[model samples]
Target: MAQKDPVLALDNQICFALYALNRAVTARYRPLLAELELTYPQYLVMLVLWEQGAGAESARVSDVGARLRLDSGTLTPLLKRLEERGLLLRQRQADDERVVRLLPTEAGWQLQEKARQVPARLMCGLGVEPQRLMALQQELRSLLAVLEGSAPSD
Candidate 1:
């Protein structure tokens, strides 16, 4: 009998692990986000907008795109839907019409209070220790930085 290549094993593939993890995490978020009437992508967009704070001040679409690693093709429709839902407003910059900015509406600000429990709720539901999750998150961030070519050289 010939030995099979261990490298070809699905369980040994980092890409498969990551893909499965992403799907599992998103699935867990589904019902929780449904309460807010948000899809996973929509929730991510809202998180960025919320971080920018509520006011006349806004975040540039490009800035949000960069933060989320999302291209306009995907982000544009999400933004449009959020805008239509009255959760956010998309406006062209006065100084530069070419630039589109985003700001959360009053309702969106209110939603933040409701969403404040989501993280804790999710963590509790997953039964994962916060410290362990934090460590995992840091490791993932490091890995992502390396993959993105932004990691510092030793």
Candidate 2:
């Protein structure tokens, strides 16, 4: 029988580290979002909408899905919940009824004001410098690109 390599242990896997970090970061966001009656994924959708500006026109559902890396199967229910809460509106496009558009409602815009401190609080809680965090994000983006085969594999 061959002995298992210690180098192949779970703790030594980069994928394990990434998975653990994702869980930890999402856990940190849980309570903060609970105050606003949002889950982390919902908060992410709102963030994308919020970026378009409070009074900005509606965005196509496909566009939102692309930005968030979510499929309709996943995004639809979240959008529905936000809609039920009067935080956003999902409408069929006039020119192309097959296409759906999403826009933040007045309540959604107001929620943004309450969410303004989330990032700062997260940074403080994590005790990480913003510059370092940004650098890490850039590195992760490159890693994802490689994983997705958009970047050359070495």
Model 1 TM-score, 2 decimals: 0.91
lDDT tens string, model 1, 55-97? 5468888888999999899999989999999998899998999
Instruction: Provide the lDDT at 62 for model 2.
Output: 84
Best candidate according to lDDT: 1
Candidate 1, which ten residues in sequence have the lowest lDDT sum? Answer: 145-154
Local distance difference test, each candidate: 0.91, 0.90
- Candidate RMSDs in order: 2.8, 2.2
Q: Which stretches of candidate 1 lie over 4 Å from their true place?
A: 1-4, 150-154
Residues 1-154, model 2: lDDT tens digits: 4778888889899889999999999999888899999999999999999998756777777888989889999999889999999999999999999999888988999999999999888888888888999999999999877777765556
Task: Tell me the spans in candidate 2 whose CA falls farther than 4 Å from its real position.
Answer: 149-154
RMSD of 1: 2.8
